[model samples]
Target: MYCEIEENWRDLDIRYLSFSNICKLNLLILDGERFPILLYDIPCALKVLHWTDCPMETLPFTDHQRYELVEIDLSHSKIVQLWDGKKVLKKLVHLNLSYCKELKEMPDLSGAPNLKTLDLDGCEELNYFHPSLAHHKSLVELNLSGCESLETLGDKLEMSSLERLDLKCCSSLRRLPEFGKCMKQLSILILKRTGIEELPTTLENLAGMSELDLTGLSWT
Candidate 1:
């Protein structure tokens, strides 16, 4: 089952409605100026949640509740943080938070082991990544383009299944992280307009890399 609110609506707060009885409701798409506080009221079987431009700074999911969400897209939302702590999200695969300019923190993703795609492009205030991202084994695509305040991508990246990484326009990042030897599947890497002056030696380990973009980089 799917539920979508009209995009033209304004100030619609559906938090008072209970969705726990809708056991099969799997998709929810909401758009508005005001954010809905329905995380606890929504059923656990929900698989897709798309709530662009929501004004909430945080997702209020209690620590004891577990949801079987597969995809969550809150791009351009006002969220500064996703949640306070890690929740078991074994079924989650895709997450998008692009253009959330006020976003300052990334939640620990150790519980979402199967996550494949993470999009954080244009999040200008985000300066750091959660440490758990360094060891993600199932992630395939990661987009960090336009994160101007980002300086480093942790100490190392060991995502063996990652195939694409986009770091374009990260003007504050001066160095590349050490890539794991097992990252042979990475095929596309974009580092355009970054502050990096030199490439890491581990770039030779990507046996499947077909595209490497280093345009606008200064080799100082």
Candidate 2:
């Protein structure tokens, strides 16, 4: 059951529940709200959540029950962080925080081992990524295109199973991290329109790479 109401929830003396519970919710799509929509233990069994342009500063839960979630799309929201710290979300596969300009940092990714796709495109305020994310053995596709403030990928970062990495249009990025020994499966590396001066010597280590894009670099 879904309803669209224009009333401001903050002005009402609402009871404990204004919406019914769906025990096995798999998909949810919330329209953009002028005011922030506060949620409690709703969508308990949710597998997918799409709340673009939501004004919430943080997500509610911070425990193991968050593991039931598989995918989340909060693009263009005012969220400053994902969670306090990384809790186990083993089933989570896709996370799209694209265009969330207010986001400053992401939680440690040690717990979300099975995450496959992470889209942080257009997150201008995100300056750094946690080192633990490089150890993600299941991540396949990572899109950091248009991240204007991202400066580096940490010195000791490593991504063992990542196949596609898009860094197009990151004008501030000047270097890549020292690739660890396990990045053998990485196949596509896109660095179009970045500020990198020269390819790192570690390029020799990516033997399995099938495509490398360096379209906007100066030859001199």
Candidate 3:
């Protein structure tokens, strides 16, 4: 069949995709229903993969696996666990899992050294953040807006590369991180409509920040 290479994924509606066939495509988006297929042979050229509204309870990705995937968006899905601290996705830069209500904990991300941004908006069931995220020497942006169930940020979260952080609607968060020294790289920090009563006096240490959003945080 002389099908155009550009049209390869145009008609993959909702069926079990044989790894060998779809593994070479640069982009893959799965919707409709979640199919059971393990051993994802991510294409060497794949740059983005989105699993919208799929009902996957567990992901079987391992840390030893190697690939060139960069963006992963699992918004509006049912992924429950990434189990244990293993991040084989070395090249991933952006990760979005907004509105995943069944998601519970943040995956241990010490292995994804190059990861720069993560978006976990609206994960109502989420309760904690990964402790190793601070170790991500390249992490720059993080969006935790609408993670209403999250209670605390784990210890050791001092990322020199962190620039922008958004925590809007984190209703249960009572305290913010304490960064006392000059943060020349820190820029934007958002905390609107949350229950937070105060900001760390370390606010003065934010040397390079251009905008700080603390619109609705009042103990009164």
Candidate 4:
């Protein structure tokens, strides 16, 4: 039987019996269940998973292996971390962890080669990003808006396929990493409401950039 969550499964011990046939799952707004849904029976073929307003401190991964997940959204959760270690998910394209207030770190994303969009907006406690993100050659859009604690980008950003980067409202950010020559595909760069006082002259090298937002900044 397909267990679509219409009501909360209170104190459920879901540690066995794999739902091997289910491909997609969405937990809309089920409440009244205890925090940390002991998930273990999840199928390997699951492609898309969206669990909003989760109270779990961390995800329950059955094992350390690359998943077939293409999209995963854990918005408004208390999760502090996504996974335990590095993983390989070639088809994983999008990952949204917006509004995860307790989230402090990101995992190694070097294996998700085709990842296109990563949304980390409203992650107030996230102070550091995994360095592997700078080397993602197929990333298209990165939304780090409202990351109040983020202080800086990595030492280098070499995303050749990136098109848009949103860093608005990152009040703690003071400096940006040097952009590589591969930033030729960048078209939109948002830097509104940040602590960045000055930008590197290397920014002028983005010949294809059509939109650059520098609002709420005073010339120094």
TM-score of each: 0.91, 0.86, 0.83, 0.86
In angstroms, the error of model 1 at 79 is: 0.8
**Tens digits of per-residue lDDT for model 3, 60-96:** 5544667667988888888787555675778889888
- Candidate 4 segments whose C-alpha is farther than 4 A from its true place: 1-3, 8-34, 62-64
* Residue 181 lDDT (model 1): 92
Candidate 2 has a TM-score of 0.86
Q: Mark the 10 consecutive residues where model 1 has the least summed lDDT.
A: 33-42
Name the candidate that leads on lDDT: 1
Query: How high is the CA lDDT of each candidate model?
Result: 0.88, 0.79, 0.73, 0.79
lDDT by residue (tens digit), candidate 4, 165-218: 999999999988888988999999999999988898779767789999999976
lDDT measured at residue 40 in model 1 versus the true structure, 0 to 100: 57
> Looking at model 1, how many pairs of residues clash?
0
**Candidate 2 — worst ten consecutive residues by lDDT sum?**
12-21
How many backbone clashes are present in model 4? 0
Residues forming the 10-long window of minimal summed lDDT in candidate 4? 25-34
lDDT string for model 1 (1-220, tens) is 9888774545755656566778999997876536465655557899998888978888766686788999999899999988887878889999999999999988999999999999999999998799999889999999999999999998788989999999999999999999889999999999999999799898899889999999998873
Worst 10 residues of 3 by lDDT: 1-10
Clashing residue pair totals per candidate (backbone < 3 A): 0, 0, 0, 0
Residue-level lDDT tens digits of model 2 in 110-182: 7888899999999989886888886788999999998888888888547888899999988999988777778
Q: Once superposed on the true structure, which residue ranges of model 1 sit more than 4 Å away at CA?
A: 7-15, 39-42
> Judged by lDDT against the true structure, how good is candidate 4?
0.79
